[model samples]
Target chain A: MSMIGDIARLPAGVPETAARPQVSVATAEDYVALLKPRVMSLVVFTALVGLMAAPGPIHPVLAFTALLCIAVGAGASGALNMWYDADIDALMTRTAGRPIPRRRIAPGEALGFGITLAGFAVVVLGLLVSWLAAALLAFTILFYVVVYTMWLKRSTPQNIVIGGAAGALPPVIGWAAVTGSITLEPLLLFLIIFVWTPPHFWALALIRTEDYARAGVPMLPVVAGAAATRRQIMIYSLLLIPVGASPWLFGYAGLVYGLTALVAGALMLAFAWRVWTRTEGKAATTAARQMFIYSILYLFGLFAVLLVESIAGRVVG
Target chain B: MDNKPDPTELTEEQKRSRRSRSIAIAMVLGVLVVLFYFVTLVKGPAVLNRPL
Candidate 1:
């Protein structure tokens, strides 16, 4: 059925604006923006590490397909998140310029787009790769959209803490794609990302407390205040040090990864310490922002080290 | 004479966006087809024998 025809058939008592066909001026780029490409890139990178690190070899085509499916799945969840959060998104300065908040895409259109891509990604993964991986991808999308976005985000300060699991699942899903099974190593990767999330996000939340407050989001800094959030960041950063080093300790990775994790993790703890100490004025915000930036580099560094070591081990052996 | 814009008529920007979205969909479909073809080539006749 034509969109115009559907609009024309609107029942009586419907608003006149609802009856009029709203022509979207959204371009392909707007749709891509809905995917949250930066987030997808991180998901792709982590999943790639998991895929390459798995025991045995995966065909190049299948490996590419697995990563593609995982990326699309992550993007789909992001689109749905934007669709649901359009109201709060408009309120926050940080998210105010997003496609939906800016009115470049309609909420319903984003919903449909997200659902379509999600189904496509899951089915493709299941068909071309392993069903276990497909199931994990489906669960990740559902967990992010339903459990995190719809349920927890507005309700609690620990939302990101629990929601981090969804983000952390990609590497596990990647491993399942390669081995068709779960193991300790992938779970270790999951643990690293899971623990890494709260401190990383809480740092941003510290700087953007006003934004979260304005949007009524219960971010840790907004709800518990910066001091408490800083303490939590310290705790998580301390925990992440041990979790990040597990792959090497467990003997899956070599000395290089072990050394990299220890040094990088200590640096992360130092940044978190700075965030913990500087709790007032411009110095505080600066500290939080620096930690936030370093958190990204710390994760990328650890995962990049793992990827390099995995590849090197494969080549040398 | 009424100066109101027609609800049925799309503005130039809307037309361009619609065209862009259409092309993106076409490209995605094309990629899916090629992907399936490659998977078939990799799996050979066993492509049909999918295990749960």
Candidate 2:
């Protein structure tokens, strides 16, 4: 018999045949996708701002190393997150195309990859930069992977609220990389991102309520309904204005940063107000989407202003 | 006698992917070496004086 005919005639449900080992076809790009490059970029940018805002001077080489370690640490957390949440990711429309969900990379492979990178990033940062910074980076990874991803994410509607701590730590880590100590300035930066995360993420959750519901993840919109989520978004947005502007109030930032914060923050409030009032049909969804998009811009604008002012001060002095 | 292909053998696509992953790992290793070298240069003799 021909090979094709023999295979076709073989027992359809044979356990032995089904147990055949398959070689991995996962490429480098699939591995990179596991790292969640978009999230890493935001981490790198925020860490850079923190490093630049620090009081002391850092060698350019050391600064680069610090940023690199923070970026890798963030990526490692993202990979581990994908590994653990692969089941939920496969169910959600937004994440269904991820490497693990698509079966391009095995969950075990992602776990190993995340662990290796996490160790390498932490060890290198400790050896090359301040161990304080390294410690913070290590804590950030643990919080994101263990505390947030494993504990908070599946359990409560306030998952991202408390989990934002991990995301807010990069700037603090960056500051520690420079000074080997934490201060009010980096804490203020932490405060801004922490407050920003809820309104930002809830806007996305508002649009993907069904996705979260299907995945059995208790996102705010899934647990509290759209009306409550919008109200919460408005509340957080209101809270963010004062928190976002506090750096200038404390005299850590210059006039440019203060003005930018007030105007941009007002716009953020306006967007949240729209999300609050337009609570029906396509208008509500559009308002949420617009707020989501603007939130990214609002954060980038605030940080870019601070970074530029810091650079300008350095040059002038 | 059956002339069936070996299930253990990699397909062409799998071979390509494996090669790409190997190259990427090699490049990362190379970059780490250069990074450590520069770090040492920047720190001078103070590199060994790591504080807890």
For model 1, the local distance difference test gives: 0.94
Error of 1 at A291 (Å): 0.4
TM-score of chain B of each: 0.80, 0.81
Error of 1 at A302 (Å): 0.5
List DockQ, one per candidate, in order: 0.56, 0.54
Per-residue lDDT of model 2, residues B1-52, tens digit only: 8687664455689789989999999999999999999999999999999998
Error of 2 at B23 (Å): 0.9
Candidate 2 Cα misplacement greater than 4 A, ranges: A1-21, B1-7
Assign candidate 1 its CAPRI class.
Answer: medium
Candidate 1 chain B, poorest ten consecutive residues by summed lDDT: B4-13
Error of 1 at A226 (Å): 0.9
**A63-171: candidate 2 lDDT, tens digit per residue:** 9999999999999999999999999999999999999999899999999999999999999999999999999999999999999999999999999999999999999
